[model samples]
Target: MTSSAGFTASLGRRRAYWQAGVCLAVLLGAVYLARSHWPALESGAGRLAVADQGWLLTGAVAAAGTWAASALAQQGAVVRRLPGARLTATQFAASAANHLLPAGLGAGAVNLRFLMRCGLPPGRAAGALAVKAASGAVVRLALLALLAPVCPGLLRLPRVSPLVVAAVLTAAGLAAVLLATPWWTRCRRALAAVLADIRALHARPARAAALWGGSVAFAALHALVLIAVTRAVGLPLAPLQVALLYLAASSAAALLPTPGGLGSLDAALAFALTAAGTPGAGAASAVLGYRLLTVWLPLLPGLLVLAVLVRRKAL
Candidate 1:
């Protein structure tokens, strides 16, 4: 009887190992294929070679500042003071993870875990994230509206084709189905909690100020980084125009539910720069340089920080 039981256990272990190997192989294959097929990944490196190093360095510094800005906004969303160092590390990790998981789930999950660890109830923690996101979105739009007038022709969007409209409607329909079916009850509860939290947060003047101010600074800094990259790539567009184009492009990219807005954001940014009077090569170089600073360069370090934070039980 003991021998028979041992044999069964060994077989089960083998099967599990085989399954894990198969899954890993599939994932790697998909990634490899994607890199080969995607023009952004293919051409970005080529453009980076010719990009001006000094402007790129400046953009990198600006990119690094974004995590700090995000941390500030997050801290301001709640009344409890979070540990500054840990909070910044968490934001960096979240940004790295955002590229791995789809539809912003990576960052959301990280922040949710961090907030719960900070002693908030699950609902309240989720509410805090909601408040932060809503505040950021509102501030971004406000900035766009404010800057559009100053940028003059930067706000002009190209004519949308019929295919684009259909694609949008299809995406909306899918989202509606998912909301209506799978998690409606939980979503309703979460929304209610978030609304309550938002009201309470707004009632606190200091927290409100921090939240709104940090959000505005975050958006502005991101635009500034892109503007720096554009200049580095020899794109001659005005600073205000670059900032406005960055805002508009980023807002459009947010609609696509990809991880970290990867391919969609790259394409949108390149198109926006080109439409704003930059040469195609220059626009491509600018987008690549900006992403190199913000995403590719920091990714490894961010992951290392994430692992350390996890080991230390900070998140």
Candidate 2:
């Protein structure tokens, strides 16, 4: 029995390693394709270097704000169930991992593991994660719906329309909400279960509101980051125009199965930016820079966190 168990463990480890390799290969291939537009990217970077630094700083702050909002949302979602559960560090680590690891799966797994380690039952932990994710989805869709009317040009794009975008987003949001209705109905129980596991925090209405507000702000900040990238690359486009373009590009990329949305994101962003009146080269540069800051720059820290988590037997 011992030998069989050891063999099973070794097989599992081998499978995990193989899966990681496959993910890495896919990520690398996508990245290589994204880099194929390097000449244009270089030109765009040159233009961005001459743009106002103040706006860029604001963009950076907005990104950080998004991170904070995400953490707050996680905290709020789990508060009722895990009253003392503090997920700030776990949130950061998970976000970092999501950005670093291919396909965003790592972050979700890490979050689940984090909750389990914190002593929440599997069902409740899963429910909390579901709620947090649902909240984020609703917030993003809500913002998109609100902004759709203001950006009719986005609707005119090939294979898309404002009404269609709105409908799709609304449907997704509704589906998520409906799927979570059971959990929401049991909110009191869920909250109590979560609260029983931790003792350092308390659930509050204000915190929940803040979490939602932060999520909205994060979505806006993400839009602003794209705008900053465009300006930095010296793209000739209004901030609002850039923001809309960024939103569309990002939305499309998120739907794709590619790791980190690599090729899809770059291509979509560059195309959308150019359509929005920026030069193709300049748009490509801005998109590249945006990826650099939001994706590549955070990879090292994410890997470090993953390593630590592994060493501690938490991952």
Q: Which lDDT tens digits does candidate 2 get at residues 1-315?
A: 999889879978996677577666656766685578667767766766676777667667666566666666666666544322235555556766775454566667788887788777787677667666666677867766777787776645478779999999999999789667764566667666544423222246665675577567666778888777766656677777776677677777776544566666777887787676766677767876787667776667767766777687664
Q: Single out the weakest 10-residue window by summed lDDT for candidate 1.
A: 19-28
Pairs of residues at least 3 apart in sequence or in different chains that clash in candidate 1? none
lDDT of 2: 0.68
Alpha-carbon local distance difference test for all models: 0.82, 0.68
TM-score winner: 1
| Candidate with best lDDT | 1
Please provide, for model 1 over 1-315, each residue's C-alpha lDDT reduced to its tens digit, 9 standing for 90 to 100.
Answer: 999889879978996566445445545654664465467545655766877889888888889899999998998888788888989999999999998865677899999999999998887887889889999889879888999988776767679999999999999999889787736776788788888877887889888888988898889889989988887767788888988888888888776656687766777787787787776667767877888888998999999999998999988
